[model samples]
Target: MTDLRVGIGSLKLKNPVMTASGTAGYGAELAEFFDPSLLGALVMKGISLEPWQGNPPPRITETPCGMINSIGLQNVGLEMFLREKLPFARQWDVPVIANILGTSADEYVRLAAELDGAGVEGIELNVSCPNIKKGGISFGRDMAVFARLVGAVRKTVKSAALIVKLTPDAPVAEFARAAEESGADAVSLINSIPAMAIDVNTRRPLVKNVIGGLSGPAVKPIAVRMVYQASRAVRVPVIGMGGITEGRDAVEFMLAGAHAVAVGTAIFSDPMAPLKILDGIRAYMENHGIKRVSAITGSVRT
Candidate 1:
């Protein structure tokens, strides 16, 4: 009975629950397990200007409460995504946010221009992927570069909402402020931390890439802090993600000033995690006599 609808700039979500990028490969793959309409939005995999083969084998490895991946923004190029994936995905009822990456500011601008006409709801600018050795995380590490990159993309995408996704490794408040100044409508945070694991018996790194991005329960606390700081730093909306597994976890992020929360690594553990979390949030609101989800946003105790 609680109103769960939330907004990210000009885009409105039915609820604050959305499938994170990379985890939900385009909405088509998860259609059988859950209805895409139930989600706030579906962010496609990180698409580039050209197709990428991604890193070599052993891209993913399991940790105690989290997982690491070096997927390297593997996906069909922007043209292919528009021609092959976007048409079909448009049939779904929920908003579709295209997640895109590029090697330079020009590439980001070009990709954003292309996606603006793709009939999707918005674009999530990927500035914090740790898998790629070059442009991914590097763009987010420096506030100046981050601002310039976002400003370039902002000039290109005339219609769609631009959401800049920031890295948790950086000073989130500073980065978020830069994103806002650069004309971002909203910002999502805490992609993943760079990490590596070793196989004791083989006495070698477990992953083929030797290093990867860590996601899941282990990163939740860091994410919350980043979101909280970011919320204060920017006047724009914030979408928080990192190791969110349950409705309570989602609530925590919202309390930390996230307008909406995204579920990433948790989907692998439970296929219906987002839906269940949505239900749990509604139930929590009802039990606590709270009339809406927005009322609880940023209400956490310091």
Candidate 2:
């Protein structure tokens, strides 16, 4: 029999496929396509203490092999999430990981503590959000600030598994190490890269924000590289994401040192992408004569 389980600290998932936070839209959104319980885990969209209206329209724009979005992390505030969103997710048997974002350390700590107390299986800190108290520098860019915030959340979070989703702007190895040292149970990497597109006809930026994060097939190679770097740097599991569109893409990530992979952009084009990718992983394992999916992690040739 094939074994597909993967563990991140004390949290052991039935498989390794997860929905990228922002794209999954609070977990319940995917229930229409399939049972969310079938997934290894459901990582819901980014959540904030107060409602984030997100950026203005023209938020999403397409590029050659991907799209750019300055969606501005729009989400329903914490109040509604606990009142409505989480109860629906609890109906499913799969692990639910809350992706929390904040403008300062206090907000993150409060969110993490609340989610942990709520009995969610996991808490992922989306450090890509800027530190409003520090002149808007993204928490992931500055190691000192980043580690301090992660540590504070760790102290506040007592039960749920903690993960740090890293930004692509810095050296992933150093950042991953810092998260692991500060008590992260796992680390997810390759948050969208900063990119922009221009319209020659109107001379307007393709995305309303002027600059948006690029994601999809175009970022796969970079995601792979960073996944390998981070995995090699830490003992904790690494969840890789970027441009994963198929099962083969997930295999590429697993071989590159990712213990798990998340599907994001493809979800926009195909709501069933996550299950398809998960199926692809099983096929690859059988073809390779591999019975344990965990063996695929960090098996890349140096």
Candidate 3:
């Protein structure tokens, strides 16, 4: 058997494969396709301080080689997740990571502390939400704002390993280093690129939101470049994600210095995508005489 285990700060994974938040729903629905425990970790959908109904209809549209979605971070409030969602995930042996977003810094801190206290193995901050008090600037887009939030959340989250999901709107290296300095144990990158699709006939936007995050194979190279830049900038682990669809795609990220990789938009097309990608990775390892998965990280030749 291959030694696929890897560690992200204090969190350990049986393999380097995880479910990207938002794509995997919660743990329960995932079981219908494959065993949830088989994954390195289950990153549940993003949760907020309050229940958000999300955007209006026609919130998603397919683009060439990818898709754009303006789902608007809709999720069950933190209360229900604690009451019903977390318990079901705890049933599995795999680690559970919570993807959290909030309108204000205090809300982020509280969400981190609550989920950390509730025994989540990891907490991934989704900092793409606009900061209401900060004149609508995204927390991840402003250096000082991003650092302050991460630093504050770090103070309260004592148990769970902190992971910041970096927004592509900022300089990759600087933001990633800031997260590491602010006490983030790891960083994940290339959260869907901002994009739009237009219906030329009607002269209208395909998605009602006018613009949405573009995800899928279209963003892989950018993801790889960012991951490469980030991993070199910070000593902490870097989790690379963008347009990973096959085993080779995951392999590219791993080579680009991602300690682990997450499957996102690919899940919409193939429910078995993660497992299949894992199999592909295993085959690549065996063929290359690589005895351990960790050996693939950062071994890319210049």
Cα-based lDDT for every prediction: 0.87, 0.94, 0.94
Q: TM-score of the candidate numbered 2?
A: 0.99
Instruction: List residue ranges in candidate 2 displaced over 4 A.
Output: none
> What is the C-alpha lDDT profile of model 2 across 13-113, one tens digit per residue?
99999999999887767898899988999998889999999999899998999999999999998989999999989889999999999999999999999
TM-scores, all models, native as reference: 0.96, 0.99, 0.99
**Candidate 3: residue 163 Cα off by (Å):** 0.2
Error (Å) of candidate 2 at residue 37 is: 0.6
- Residue-wise C-alpha lDDT for candidate 3, range 1-302, written one tens digit per residue: 78899999999999999999999988888789899899999999999989999999699999989999999999999999999999988888899999999999999999998999999999999999989999888899999999999999999999999999999989999999999999999999989899999999999999999999999998888889999999999999999999899999999999999999999999999999999999989999999999999999999999
Per residue, candidate 1 scores C-alpha lDDT tens digits across 16-101 of 98889999888777887988989999988889999989999888999988998988788988888989888878778999999988
